[model samples]
Target: MSTQPAAERETVLIRSARDVTELVNSGAARGSHAKMIVLLALGGIFLDAYDLTSLAYGITQIREEFGLSPAGAGAVTASISVGAILGAWLGGVLVDRLGRYRVFMADMLFFVVSAIGCALAPNAEVLIVFRFLMGIGVGMDIPVAMAFLAEFSRLRGKGSKGSRTASWSPAWYVATSGCYLVILALYFLLPDSQHDLLWRFTVGFGAVPAIVILLVRNKYMNESPSWAANQGDLERAARILRDSYGVDAVVAEDAERPKRESKPRASLHQFRTLFARRFRPRTFQALAVALAQTFSYNAVAYGLPIIIASLLGQGDLNTISASLVLNLVFAVTGGLLGMRLANSAGAWRMTFWGFAVQLTALVVLAVIGDPSSTAWVLLALFALGGFMFAQGGGPGANFMNFASLSYPTELRGTGIGFNQGTLRVGSTLSLFFFPVLSASFGTGVFWVIAAAPLLGMVALLAKRWEPVGYDADAVEHEYQQRLATPEPARG
Candidate 1:
């Protein structure tokens, strides 16, 4: 080793796009930077969870106000997700083409504006339109935000223990818990006199937080180092590492001849390369995880307040509010533990066990199928709690983590966005179909929900892939090399 410090050595240099990640993975040195990325991702997801979950609590009131039929109500609820599918695909393209920080600011503005529009809407039609608009923002945020977190996670130093991508689990649980808490408070504070206005206020309340997030983001947000380097701006990437992430990266004189250990930059056509035979299976794994998690969770978790009201007796707000509180507590608790465990055990382990927990819950609910019985109702609540606990720690949090982390930096945004798009498909399906199914089948609806997790389990067993400690650049490079050779690549 040279006697001079790496930072002071004039000959030191960044050779490839991976150099950005190498420095970032330096751990605590990237604390404020990583924290900022985490906070941004957390805020974006929080707004999404709040906006998406808040509607569940308000739908009854909203239905009453708009005189909606079951089909209409379902359509309205699913509309946001419908818009999200398109937004996610488009957002991924934009982030890769335009930039992360640019898309980040614009998406928040979408949420802020749509929240206001939803609050002031005079009819169900108008509210649905705005919610759809808001969904675009929600959809767009995931790819960039998750990409930001995954890229910043850096695999070196302290972060070597657990990927920074793990922060998303706890952040999302906080958002869900926060939504329940806010809804609970709204229920208590608003009297019967203001019952009709309650949903509007609660939904619109999201705007204030969005504004606060905007302010913090304006001053602090910076482009992803890997992205900058990928765009052939190594100097800017180095500055970002040193200034924003506390990494003192220095470019060696022989940067043109990169150290053999450094991963070379990938071509710009990386997004198109995702569908190749080698990557197709991994893509399927990501889609399966996202779709399964969203479809199952949206059916029960999003509709918990309504489910609680119906099970415990519908007239009193206290019972509904209490159930919401309890459900969120369990979810947040489970999410925190899962977040901790995912870092240590890997996301694949969490997803496998998570499905197992949900499977048991669904089966028990199916067997004890009488909501009329007090004991059965209580058991249902316990089962619900158990399922949420597993979800928070397992697939709910890791779906995006895997999507964002599994791909090369060039394709990370597109990969996560693709996952979000699939998630929206599941969300729209469940949100639209669940109310109708529940109306006809009652708690028997859970037997169907159970099928989603079961499929996830089967896929996991058959595919047998894991992303923990994955090497995105090397993996992509290896795939490319295999393609160049005569034979196909195989494990």
Candidate 2:
């Protein structure tokens, strides 16, 4: 059963379900481990948000300094998202192969190194390269954090209930807004001659959270017990639950969990398993939703500062700061709404309505507003930020669930990874194209951009099914049974 010798001590008892209930509801469950995991997981998101917003704020300054054309500026802007696409794919594979804790730790280390590299870059080329490297860390961390959040949040902590995984990512946005606030404060404090260091300091400050979390990771972090269970090490899984979160999960006497028939253990095989017929619908759903949302969100929501600065006909830092503050307010509100609905309405439902509302708001903005005129621009941004709240709260919650539910426990990280990876791809495309589109199409670009989520709404309405109340084990069992005994073809 346990690979360790019989004489080795067990960390916590794994006797019964009642003990699990007790442990999950206990004070310790909320105090150290849960809080630590959530805070650590948010680190990458904070960096991602801060970098995008700060870079957007500094874009005009950077472009003038580097003598960059709009296209050249866009390239620097798009670099991180491009790198994130590759990083998410690589990180997903590594997480499935090396284990979640290891890959997560490695990702944080990458952030620290990348942040310093980004700060020290001498030119646009070097900045792009460094930003891409930083993106790799950003890409990998989102899905891993989701996986961590899904597992950690499930154990009904004090007043914390079922699968409110969406709330997890939004916490990082709060951290992100904090970064923007810091940068804004620095702008007010420093003289105009020192502007170059402003962006550098913002990027540099991102690594602090990562370093702080990495140091304490081993002291409190726990591996996913469900993931261990999927690997057939029920005893080890049980041990993790008991020791890490103080949960008392029962391990069978044999100390091995049952496996799906013909399950594959290799990483490549695990990747393929995600696309198995049983999983294809959900996989597609995850991909579509992740892709559409990133395209829309980054193009508009994170792009708010730039959009607002342009409309105001003012290049002042104060203008950008005010817009960002508004965006953060909506983001937090959206996150709270999504967290509240994630369990009650079902992930797909929340995601669908969220996207629908976002689309409606975007269309309203396109219909009533003009970017070239300063008068209506602030109103457009308010609508943009308001819609963003739904996006973050609604789809933000949904993506974690989508990532977590689209595969068996053994490959949960892969599911989350691939979905986030797909989102990064979409974000990269938006990053590269949105500027071109906006420059060429002007106000018409908003209307055209709204189509992405309209398609998402259609996709969800056509194919999405409820997963909230569905037990993972039951789904796997029934899916396997249907596969084994095919029904005769009807004439």
Candidate 3:
């Protein structure tokens, strides 16, 4: 059942267009299949999303349970990001070195472990520790999954079916919304006095998707041939094609070509190579886009529950649930819009316009919102939420499109890992600092948060290059030509 290398494993060099075409055609098969993978892969993120929103849900309870203050709850909440930082740093290296299919399956183990730990935590200290570990797993999954989605979509084709599968990411937003709904359901079903189990069940239910994925993963998951070929593993590459597409068999001679003898794989150095001249500009672009998306998206969406909860001044669970549902709806709407635009408009263009829209929304939010007094604040929040989807979700929709296009096939995964790793760092920083900034600065702090999208707009404007609808080779060739030209000698 397994194609484990026996004795000495040989790399298969794929030289035929026929094989590559077949490989891609097979991948694009069912419009819904990619969605299934997205749901499965994003299972880890669903937990992260649920846990993140639920922290707000569970925070009130935790504060009471631990006899703590707001600062203590903030500390517990931020710890997950610290853990995610560690996970993001290392997860990229591990995923790049290991096959995507294998890592895809194995990484879930971390999520499972952390979930159990979170559910069983005995003290505030212990809860924070477990939550951080779970965050690490969550942080690592996004880049890998995005790479998988992009590659799978490209192999499948960039058409309706491909679009359908790619759009599965919005399902995560839906799933995340369901998480809050679950909390509301549990609140009504369970006795008010039996609140102890609420957080446990909310966090625990996150594992169900992973378990379902585990069962189906073996049957459907195949190592990406393009990824294997990039790693210089031709035999493994061919085997993947044989297993997955069945139509793209490499010829024996090409399949048996001698593998290149290269330097020992340096995951760390490869990680840094992302910022080298060849990759640096786009690396920064990808990072900025991700940062803009994350900062704006997290600031507005995650903060929505906090804002609504705080503003309503002693609202029922239903209000909190409604706020979360609204966040999910607008977020999914943005993601769907991004999916529509991904193929036609450039990712950077979508990013620029999205951020521009977001900036406008945030400005309106700052001008009109009186967190304490204004009912109009909710209207701004909804528009801001919808605008945010385009900003982050648009670029977030296409980080892989840019990353995959920027680097050569051989370094695609490494490039993606490093790029994503950088974004995760930014995300962690944003998550950690936003609350502090908000507390010290007040609701008007959104004005400061508003600056992030502007920065994204500046970065996008200064470095804009259209990458959509082009093959990797053509994009690389253009970059090489641009790099080879001698810059005018400085005076």
Candidate with the greatest TM-score versus the true structure: 1
1-491 per-residue lDDT for model 1 (tens digits): 88544544443358766566555554434547656766776788788878887778788788888999888989888988988998898888777767788998899899999999998999988999999998899889888887777766755333442345666666776776676677667767888788678778878988988898888875577888878877766777777777666656766555544332343333335555667776778888888888888899988877676667764455646655555655567777777776676667888888889989999998987777767777877777788888888888888766766687777777878777877887789899999998788778877888899999998888788787777677776677667678778965778
lDDT of all predictions:
0.76, 0.69, 0.63
Q: Count the backbone clashes (under 3 Å) in each candidate.
A: 6, 1, 5
Selected candidate, larger TM-score, 1 vs 3: 1
Best by lDDT: 1
| Model 3 agreement with the true structure over 1-491: per-residue lDDT tens digits | 45543211333335643334334534432224444554565565565566666665676667678886656766777777777666666666666677567767766777777777777777899888888877777767755675565555553235422243235446557666787788888888999888767887777776676777778886677666666665566666666555654433454563434344552363767877777776788878877776776776666665665555654343657455666557566777777777676666656777678787788877877776565555675676666666646643565555556665566544566766666566666566666565566667656867988888898888888787655655554455467578879989989
Judged by whole-model lDDT over C-alpha atoms, candidate 2 comes out at: 0.69
Question: 200-314, model 2: which lDDT tens digit per residue?
Answer: 8877777887788788887877676555555555576667765665444456453323463444653777678788877888888878877777788888865666666663344
Per-candidate TM equals 0.90, 0.86, 0.84
lDDT of 2 at 50: 64
Error in Å for residue 473 of model 2: 3.6
Ranking by lDDT: 1, 2, 3
Tell me which residue pairs clash in candidate 2: 166-397
Clashing pairs in 1: 11-252, 12-251, 12-252, 13-251, 13-252, 25-154
After the best TM-score superposition of candidate 1, give how far the Cα of residue 263 lies from its true spot, in angstroms: 16
For candidate 3, the lDDT comes to 0.63
